[model samples]
Target: MDQLTQIIAVLGVFLYWLILGAVATRIVIKRRSIGVSFSWLLIIYFLPFVGVFAYMLFGELHLGKARSSRSKAMYEPYGKWFSTLYSHNSHQPDKQSDYAASISKLCDSQLNIPSLTSNELELQHTPEQILHAIINDINHAKTTINMEFYIWHPGGLADEVAKALISAANRGVKVNLLLDAAGSRQFFKSEWPKAMKKSDINVVQALIVSPIRMFFRRMDLRLHRKIVVIDNHIGYTGSMNLVDPKYFKQGDGVGEWIDMMVRITGPVVPVINTVSAWDWEVETNERLLPAFPDKAQCTDTSSLVQAIPSGPGMPEEVIHQVLLQSLYQAQKKIVITTPYFVPSEQLLDALVTASLRGVEVNIIIPRRNDSTMVKWASSSFFSELLAANVNIYQFNDGLLHTKSVLIDDEHCLIGTVNMDMRSLWLNFELTLAVDDIKFATKLKGLLQTYMDNSDRLSHDEWQKRPMYRRVIEQVFYLFSPLL
Candidate 1:
């Protein structure tokens, strides 16, 4: 062969071996599922040079030290607080003793989280209500305020919230704000309010991305948490980002953004505040402790709540395991509402098994997804679920961003966890696991609202799509393991 042809052959051979080595390394190091491993192998084999680069850049899984430090810092305070609360609360016998013990077992087994007493959880629906609650809480803050969100824009309601934060800071409340670099790129590009700095408010960006750093980090792994902790006593978290009506406003006659938020007080607020502090410490080299006076005296009479935080840095997929276990334990019903519905194989099996065992399994997903590929991949799962007797509903009114799970009308999970591989393994996510019948009932009511507006997909309806669309879904499904 001529020199050029020999050179080309040698380069191709080198690329092939490199990819093989990378795949083998990932399997050994990450210990990912067979599907994920095989999917990586296929990507490298079929896509050649581009695939190799993508794998090198985005495929190498590393549970880095930063995540570990953040998790440790976040959980240490909770551990201390929980140890004290459990000793005090577990000794006294009450009506919620069994529920508290169950919560303790769940924390120890599933999330390794410590259970605390003296926390109140109030479920709030609608953006307007949540916003009003947040503003009211901030206005009453005496010591400090911490706000962290994936998105922060200066317009409409967001602008008003920003003004509220500034006002709180000006009123001697120490305000610390953190926004995800990837999600709030616009806020960073344009100078944020200079008055924030003037008012002694600290603002930091989480996971800043640069052109050079993009080669190593997948920008998709976002800090997709929305938390606002005030006075280390009151907290808020859910699907709502700190944006305005423009985001939800139906341009071209679409629909409004429907979401949910939970206002939490008592012991869980400190946990949420600790997580915010951990995130702030990771971004800026400053450690923050609770600034407010101790006011975590048990206020509510019923229900138990545990705050669970999971991310790539964690040893296990705690949130995913929790969901799977809940599904297995679900006897009557499993109701889930998420904007995205691309679940992993294990999760799919759990849902399918539950459905086959006569559990009323229902999932509500958005009819119009922001991500096209994810929508296709999600749609592909309908056939299998339909076959297994699982009910599926598409929210046709607007985009559904609520992430919640109601299991058997006895337990509920609410927070940032979405039923997707990204949420399960990559993102730093938080969810409040509640063992309250009332909370579960409230969650069921919220799910029912979506179900009322949504259109149920029958097997016939799903199978009636065009052949090309089916092919597209199948193609997307083939890569679902990767997604």
Candidate 2:
């Protein structure tokens, strides 16, 4: 009995050292952020076996080699499409200062999509307004209607849109719908897909999650883009999902979500559709041909727009790079509205330095959040931000779910990229970069409305929180890198 006990103890020690050696090597080779590396090191050293399992599951990007190769091949045709499109259009003049212009150019280079001119953009604020615009566009579709969303709940908003899509498909319109397998799981559990199939609408699930499929890809990577293309002439993209804002989830304590969407017309529609097409192709294993815009319908609009898509399959962190560049170029003010605020160290540093350099840095988040852990983790950075003169606002009306940024009234970025680690590193997100004064001014007005509905957090008040709350928040903040 004594010899057996000694042998088991020796094996346990050997396993512990093996896990420690493997984790240490991974941290060094992955070259992740300092915070993330240190956090993993601490967790692995402290915990016995659970930390190693968590690292294997969540600490790495595992989109599989075959999937990654296919994604690269998919971009080849998209590159050619952009090349031809950019050659025909006359380049718009740089209306921005040198700094802002450089930021715009950086996005263009990173996204491989030019800042397209001659596009008209309309901002829709309320859920009713956004759903109405989408349904109206779908009803008028002549050629094709392509829809993709992270969540498509089977409520009134989704049912109304589904009805319109079914009607369109019945009229010989090629209708394609793509929903994230995980996000729309509830919808699929109903008869909505059956109804769509009965109407002959093509439906595909993106990033389907299953126990067997877990061997091929990471379950954390999700398609979070909300996009809709109608007739190859009109498009919609923003933070609004198909679910009703008033009832986002089962027990959303916050009030109805205040979200926004942009209805687009002109040349940028095709560019936006190209992304939807690529997503569909990736999921369905079928190439969707890019829709061509009618020459007669294209006019001389002035808005310069670029679509930036980021995900695990991509080699570069495109949105992260573009956002950092925009922040660095902020001359007057930086106003950001996001539901989540757990930012990367690089992004947090950029906001801090911008505020210290006399730039008005403002961030608006919800007073009531769906995730308690996220809310606590987000508050942990308030001390540093407030010390740097960065003003923080807690939206009192409801959840301020819009993910948008306005920099010096010269650049406006809107879409589904939240200011959190999940949106930055795990999920696939799409953002629109608009460099037009007219649109920026209008967006600024919308942001001011949010400010009117929020209460600014004072530095002293933030620091005076209870001792236990601060300790708990700091503990949650330690897990922000993995959030």
Candidate 3:
């Protein structure tokens, strides 16, 4: 055969083997029960080089062994203490019926947070408030400080925070900073300050991209968790990233970013610490033992808080299951606020089913989302929800990043989990389940503020949107599960 014919034959054989390898890999990965493998396989097959590149660079899962081991070791000492506290405080025989019984039942596990009996919770609304609380907590840290965020810029408020962390580290407090490699790619590339390097501050990036896996994964998976644990006593978790206005600022326009952060002092802190340790260990390969809080010498004022962490590493998708359960258990009302609203089919059905059952179900989303595709996907659900008598509200003022769920004024969950496939399946997310009547009432008040400012969509109005827009939304919805 001529040289040209031999080249053609070689190419044909390579393509055949590639196709076979892809098919076999998909079957084996699916049988092994790896999460989202099928969706990834479809991406790889359809997009070929690009799909494989993205997956290798971004899709490989890291379980944070070092952090998990450290957390297990640290918690071992206080495991008994937590168990005793949970057992003793959980038996609320004298509890009075305050809200809807159905709501109580839906949040029974969240309501019985063992550390809330003596701890106090302060809800910080604005960016300034959150920044101040974080600074104050870092300032007050005596023993150790753990901080993790998806985004950490080097200037503005982030600069201030970096300085604070450096000062804390200089003061002999052990400081560990965990940042998402994708989120803070710029920060990692830029120069590091001498003070930050000299201080015993350990910084590690989650999910570092490797040259070999560059073709298979790139951006589909991320850490997406924001947490701050100080002295193993105080904890902070929310949808906020450690970046400033310039990062998200629209050209010549003020970038408005809205987020809700909660500061909890109770047994929940230890859990938050464990999550941090887990992430740290995954990035640095150093085991972190749990650091138990010193016994309180004074009365604690925080409410009951349970820090529930969920991700692919867990045995099940606890956050998704809990939200679905809450939706099913709703009798009077179901309120949800999330920046990303691309939910699974099951979640969509639950919401529609609840609304059909005469329950008042409402969802709050931003009028203009940062992500064009996600915005289109979210809009795709509007028609179906409106037809089912579900109220849809779009925040007109700013980007709504808060992930909140309020059910019948009795059960409320607020934290880092978004109503999207990533939060449910890929990212390590944290949420606080609050069953306190007072806390729920306060959260409801916050929801009301957003609702007041939001523009509610009527069925007729949603249906009246342009045909082209509707088509785009529908197309996006078809792939929402993979998003």
Candidate 4:
């Protein structure tokens, strides 16, 4: 009995040491941020078995070697197409402005999108307005309609848009639809996709996560971009998902969601089309020609718009860079609204630094969040921001789902990216950078409306929170890096 026990003990020690070595090797090999690597290291060291399993599922950003290679491969064709069509632009006089030059140069060098002038943009605030406008645009589609969303629940406006897409497809307009598998998992498994397929509308699921594929591809990396292009003339993007605001989920307490989207027309349309094409090619391996190769000249507007697409496939974080630069450029004021605010250390520091430099920085978030963990993690930053003289507002009207940034009265960014780690590092996101006084003024007005309905959170109020809640929030904050 003693001999057998000794042999089992030896085997157990060897296995434990092997697991430690394996976990350490994986964390080091991934080349993650030091803070993130250290966090995972600590987890693996303390909770050996559970950490090993969690690391296998979510620790490493292994989005599949084959998929990563294919994403890179598809970019070449996207580059060629963008270069060819964008080179012939005759109405790019606004690109020479200093305000446009700084941001344009940054994005051009990093994201391959030039600062484009001659674009008309309209901001839609309510879900009803946004959905109606989208369906109308779909009904007016002449040649093609391309749509992509993170969450595409079928009902209400989604059903209306579905019927419109079906009608457009029957009329010989090539309709293409793409939705993230994890975001729209139930929809992907429903009969809606099959019905759309039968109607000749090409549909593709982005970054599918399945039991079999989970062992190969990273299931955590999702496609969170929201894009829509109609006949290469009209495009829409923002935080608005395809589901109704009233019935987004089974939740009962939270009221209607307040979301926003931007409708664009001009040279920027083709640029947005290129983003959709790149995603389509990456998932379906089918190159999509521009619905309208030749863009219409629009000298009626002075807005210089650029569509910046950022994701794991890219060599750099394009939107994150823009956000940081915009914060530094803020001289008068900065107003931001997002559903999630679990920002990276760099982003949080930028906001604090900007406020310290005498810029008025206001951050608006929902009063009640969809994720309790995210809400607590977000609240932990309030004390630091309040000390920096940054105004923090929690929306009381409803769930403020708009992801937007307005810097001063001339620079603005509206899109699907939230102020969170997952948006900045893990998921694919898109943003529209607009440099126009008129548009920025309107955006500022809209933000003012939100402020009028929000309750400003004071540092004093934050300190009065119960001890247990504070402890829970701080604990969640420690895991913000992973969040």
Q: Estimate each model's TM-score.
A: 0.91, 0.95, 0.84, 0.95
**Candidate 3 lDDT tens digits, 38-122:** 5566666677677765555545553444444544564444344444544544324233233323333433453222333445677
Top TM-score hit: 2
User: Can you write out model 4's per-residue Cα lDDT over 112-172, one digit (the tens) per residue?
Assistant: 6676777789989887898899999998988989999999987678778888999999899
Relative to the unseen true structure, what is the Cα RMSD of model 1?
Answer: 2.9
Q: What's the count of clashing pairs in each model shown?
A: 1, 0, 25, 0
What C-alpha lDDT, on a 0 to 100 scale, does residue 424 get in candidate 3? 84
For residue 472, model 1's alpha carbon misses the true position, in angstroms, by: 0.8
For residue 240, model 1's alpha carbon misses the true position, in angstroms, by 1.0
Cα lDDT of model 2 by residue, 1-483, tens digit: 999999999999998898789888988789888888888887787776888866776678877666677778877787888666656453454544565467557766766566667788999998888898888888889989998999998887768888899999999999999999999998889888999999889988888899877767788888999999988889999998887765467467788778999999877888889888878877776888675655423254567777787786554678888888889989899999999999999999999999999999999999999888899999999999999989999999888899999999878899999999889888888899887788889999999999988999999988899999899988988888877
Q: What is the lDDT of candidate 2?
A: 0.84
Candidate 2 residue 41 Cα shift, in angstroms, is 2.0
Best-to-worst ranking by TM-score: 2, 4, 1, 3
For lDDT, the strongest prediction is 2
Q: Select the stronger candidate by TM-score from 3 and 4.
A: 4
Name the lDDT value of residue 420 in candidate 3. 90
Model 3, residue 367: distance off in Å is: 0.9
To one decimal, what is the Cα RMSD in angstroms of model 4 from the true structure? 2.0
